[model samples]
Target: MTSAYAAVYKEWRDDPELFWRKAAKAIDWIKAPQKIFDAGAGVYGLWFPDAVCNACANAVDRHVEAGRGDQAAIIYDSPVTGTKRTLTYAQLQEEVGTLAAVLRKHGVEKGDRVIIYMAMIPEAVIGMLACARIGAIHSVVFGGFAAQELAKRIDDCAPKLVLAASCGVEPNRVVHYKPLLDEAIELAARKPAAVLMLRRPQEPATPTQGRDFDWTAEVEAARAQGLFADCVPVAATDPLYILYTSGTTGAPKGVVRDTGGYLVALEWTMSNVYDVKPGEVFWAASDVGWVVGHSYIVYGPLIHGATTIIYEGKPVGTPDPGAFWRVIEEHGVASLFTAPTALRAIKKEDPAGTWLQRYDVSRLRALFLAGERADPDTIQWAEKILNVPVVDHWWQTETGWAIAANPLGLGMAPVKYGSPTFPMPGYDLSVVDDLGHDAGRNEMGTILLRLPLPPGNLVALWNQEARMRAGYLDDFPGFYKTGDGGYVDDDGYVFVMGRIDDVINVAGHRLSTGGMEEVIASHPDVAECAVIGMNDAIKGEQPCGFIVLKAGTSGTHERIEKELVQLVRDKVGPVAAFKTAIVVDRLPKTRSGKILRGAMKKIADHDPWTTPATIDDPAVLDDIADALKAKGI
Candidate 1:
C-alpha cells in the first residue's frame, strides 16, 4: 500500500546532490557545471554556477533537433476572440528566432532587461523566449495591470524595450492595452528605448513611427531576410527573468530567477510532480504574468517537450461553465492545473454538474490546484463530479514550482482531505514556533524551510539583496520563513491554513481564519467564503465571514447566516467567536483570484483602505463596506 513517493523520498534524502545532478541531466546544458550547489557565497545559494546554457535552446531548439519538430508545442485557445491555433515545435522555434532578431535589431543586447506587457497569447510566449534566446532578461507584467503599477515595474527594472499588444479581449469587454502602455511609459522615471506593439486584427491601433513599431511587421521582415538571433551562452547564475510580486502593502518586490537552476528544477517537476510526458497536452489555466504561468504554462511543459495550452478565457465565462471542459476535450489535455478560486466559481455556476458531464475528460490524468489553499469541500466536490484525482499542492511566487504535492507521477497517495500531502524531493519544510524551534506534530505554527532553497527558487530580490536576506533568511537565521501559519500532522502531511498574519486573536486563543472559512465553505449552499478578524472591544477580535452562495440556491439571508455560524461554532468551537456572517454577491479579489482578505479586514474594522491596482473589481470593496454597514456591524 506504500506509495512510490516513499522510495523517491528516501533516495532524495540519502544524497541530495546526486538527486539534483540526475535531475539536471534532463536538459541539454551547453557547459555543465562541475559543482552541483554552492552555498559559500551568501544566504542566496547558487546552483550550477559554472554551467553555461540557453533557456530557449533547452525549451525550443533541443526538441526540434531531436526530430520532434512537427509535434505541436503550443495550442493557443482564445474563447474571447473565438480563435484556436496550434504551433508546431519547428514553427515555434522559427517564430521565436524571428522575434529575437527583431529585438536585437531594436538594440536589445545580452543582459539587458526587456519589459513584456502583452496579453495571454502566443506572442507573449514568443517575446519571453526571444529575450531568453538573446540572453536578455525579461520582466513580464500582467496585461491587466494598471498603468501606475506597470510604470512602477518599468522604473524598477529599467528595461531597454517594452513589448506589448494593442488590446486584450476579455469575456465582456475589449481592454485597450496600447493606451495603458503609453500612460505607463509617460509615468515611468526611466522609459524604455522603444515599444513593440503587437496589433490584433480585431482591434487595430495606430503605432507611432519612431518610438513605436509594429511587432508583426518586424517579425515578417526579419523572417523574409532569413535573419535569426543565435542563442547565446550564459553563465548558470546569469539573470533569466525578474518577476514583480504585488504585495498587500508597500511597493512590489521583484524576484530574480536565474537561468540554469530554473530549467533543471522545472524539468524535474514535469516528470515528478505533474507526470507529464513528451507531446502530452498540459494546460495550466493562468495568466503568463504570474509565476505559475512562467513555470508551468510556459517553461516546464516546453522543457519536457510537452504541448502547452495558453488559454485566454475565464473559468466560468467566455461562454459558460463548460468552457474548461470543452477546452480539455478539444485539446486532449492530459494534466490540468488551476487555482482553487476558479474551481469554486465553476462549482457555483454549475452546481448540478450538468455542464461538466457534457464533455469527455477521460484523457485528463490529473487536476492540480494551487495559488490559494484548496478547501476540502471544493476538492471533494471536484473529485466526485469530474471523476478525477484532485490534488492540492502548496508553493509561493518566491518558489517557482510546487514544494509539496501528492506526486502523481510517482504514485497516488490516499487523499488527505485538505492536506497537500508531503514536501517534494528537494524541499526541507517544517512547522516552527515563535522561537524558531520545530513544533510538535499537529501543532499549528509558522512554516519554514531549511536553507539552502532548492534550484528554481528565487535567488534574490531584484536590486534588493539586502531586503531579500532580511525578509527571508534573517528571520530565523538558517530557515526561510514562509510567513504562513500551518501544521504538519503525525503522518507528515502539511496543511497550509493561511498567511500567518491572517490568524485572529479571539480573547486569549488564536484561530486561523482559513480554518473557519473551510468550515463555512463546507456548507452545501456556500460556494466560497472569506473570513476576517473584525476588531471587537470585548473579544479583542471576532471572526466575520463573507460568503457567496451557489447558483439556483434560494434561502433567507438570516437562515443561511445562522447555518454558517452554527457550522463554524460546531467545527471550531465557541472560542472561534464566529457569530456574524454576510452574504455577498462577490468577493474582492486580485486578478490572480486570491481573496483580498486585507481589504475585507479593513472594511470589517471600518478603516479606510485604498483599492489596489491588482484588484479585479475595486467597487466590490465598497459593496462589502455597504453590506457591513447594512448589517449594523
Candidate 2:
C-alpha cells in the first residue's frame, strides 16, 4: 500500500520548494514568502527568505479569526496544585494580548530578548506568546534550574525583562522560584530592567516594591485600559526564541530558532508525525523549558489548532503510577508523547501492569517516545502492557521537530524493536565513517545530514556563529554532523545506538553503551541501567554498568551482577568487555529524567567532577562515587 507518509515524502523530495510552499499555506501569513528556501546563504539554510509574519497570529489569533474562537487551545492540568484550567482560542488571545501590552509598557520592543523563568503554569505559555506577539525573543529557563545557571543565561542573552513566578508546586514540596530569581538577578552581569512576578494563590508571595511588579495587576490594568499590543510583522529569518543546550565542554550553546520556518515545520508535524486532527486532544508530557515541549506541547499542537495539555505533574508522584494513564482517560488524549525514561520509571513502579487495567486508554490512538534512545525491552513491555503501538522517534534540541518517526498519521509502519523508524520527509540522513565517507548498511557510524538543513533547524548559535560552524558544520564539511552514532538496516530503518562520545573503545573493539544497557535492562531483576566506559591499563576502556533494580526484586547484588555480566556477554559478544555491574538504589538523572551518563562516566574514571546544576538528585552522585571507591576501579 502507498502510505500517506510515503506519498508526502515522495512529493517533498521530488520538489522541496513546491512542497514547502504548499505546506506554508497552512499558516496565515501577513506577507506570503516569495521564495521557499534559500540554500545559498552560508551554512545556515534560510526558509521563507522574504516572508513576514507573526508566530503568535498563526498560533492563536488565526483560529479565533476563522470562527474557531470557542475551541479549546490549552488545557492546564497541575495535579500538584490540584488546579485545572482550560483556555479557549478567544480567551487565550485576550490573555496574550493583555500581557503583550504590559510588556510594551515595560519598554520591551521588537528584537528585545525576554527571559521567562516561571513554572509550568498558563502564564508561561502566555509569556511566550506575548513575547512573540511583540516580536521579542523569549528564552525560557527550566523552573528547577539553579541560580547560577539562570544567571549565565541572563548574562548571555541580556534580556530586557524577566518573567517569573513565586513558587512551583511539586508532590513532595514547593519550590520557591522567586528567591532563585532574586539571587540570579544579583549574580547576573547584565540585569534585566524589570522582573514580573506571578503569584501562585496556594503559596502567596509578595513582590519587591521597586524591582518586581505583580503580573496580575499589570495585566488587569492593561485590560481595563483596553490596551493591546499589535502583532509586529517580522522577517522570516527573525529569531523567535533562543534555547540553551549543554555541550560536552560544559558551556551552554544558545540555539536560535526562527519564526516562519519553525511554524510551518511544527504545523506539518502535528498532523503528519503525531496523527492528530484539529481539535483533537494531544499531550506531550514534557516541560516548556525543553525542545520537546517547545515543539510538541506548545507550538506544534497550537499551530495545528489542536488542544495541547500542559501537565505539571510527575509520572509517578503527583498521584500514583497511573497518573499518565489517568490523564489520557480524563482528557481523551488521542496522542501521548513522553520520554523513554519516564516510561521506564512507570514500568518499574508497576511491573505487573496494574496501572494499565485501571484506566480506559482506548481513546489513545498512539504512544510516542523520544528525548533519548528507547530500548527494545522497554518498547516491548510498553506495547504488551498498553496494547498500543509504542512509537519511538528521534530528534534533538537543534532540530526542533522529529527527524525520524513511525508516522502513524500517514500509515502505521511495523514497529521495529530498537529502531526509531524511517527519516522524516524533509531530512536526508546518512551514516558516515571517521573519514566522513558513507558507511555500509548495518554498520554503526556517525549520523550526518546533507545540507542545506530542513526548516526549523537551528539557524545559528546566539552570538557564537563561529562556534556553531565549528561544532556542527566543520566536522563533516558539507554535512551537518549530528554527533550521534547509529546505523540504518537494509530496510532503511535507523537505529540510534547513542551519542558518539558514549561509544566505548575496548581493546581495539568499539561497543555502544546503549546496546549494553539494553541487554542489562532486559534482565528481570533490573529496572533501569546505565553503562559508562572507564579507563583501563591493558584495555583502552572497560564497560561499567550501573543497575537499578525493580521494586521488590529478590536477588543478591553479587549474583545479579554476575548474571548481568554474563547476559551482556551472551547478547552483545565476549569482546564487549562488560566486566562489572553494580546494583545501586538510584541512578543520577536530570529533572527531565535523562540519566547523567557523563557524570557517571567521570565517576567511573575516578576523575574530579562537579555535580551538574540540572541534576534531579545530587545524593546519587555520592552513592556512585562510594560504590566506585569500594570496587577500587
Model 2, position 591, has a per-residue lDDT of 79
In model 1, the clashing pairs are none
What TM-score fits each model? 0.99, 0.98
**RMSD of candidates 1 onward, in order:** 1.1, 1.3
lDDT of 1: 0.91
**Candidate 1 C-alpha lDDT tens digits along 1-633:** 357998898898899889889888887889987898988854556999889999999999999999999999999999998899999999999999999999999999999999999899999999999999999999999996898888889988999999999998888888899889889889999989999999997668888768999888888999899999889999889989999986435656999999999999999889988889999999999999999999988999999999999999999988999999999999999999999999999999998889988999899988999999999999999988888889899999999988899988898888898899999988889998878788989998999988888899998889888888888888888889888899999898999999998888999898899999999999999999999999999999999999999998887988999999998889899889899999999999988899999988987887887888789889999899899999997
Residue 376 lDDT (model 1): 97
TM-score, model 1 to reference: 0.99
What would the per-residue lDDT of candidate 2 be over residues 116-217, giving only the tens digit for each residue? 988898899999999999999999999968888888899989999999989888898889888888899899999999999998885577777788999999
Runs in model 1 with CA error above 4 Å? none
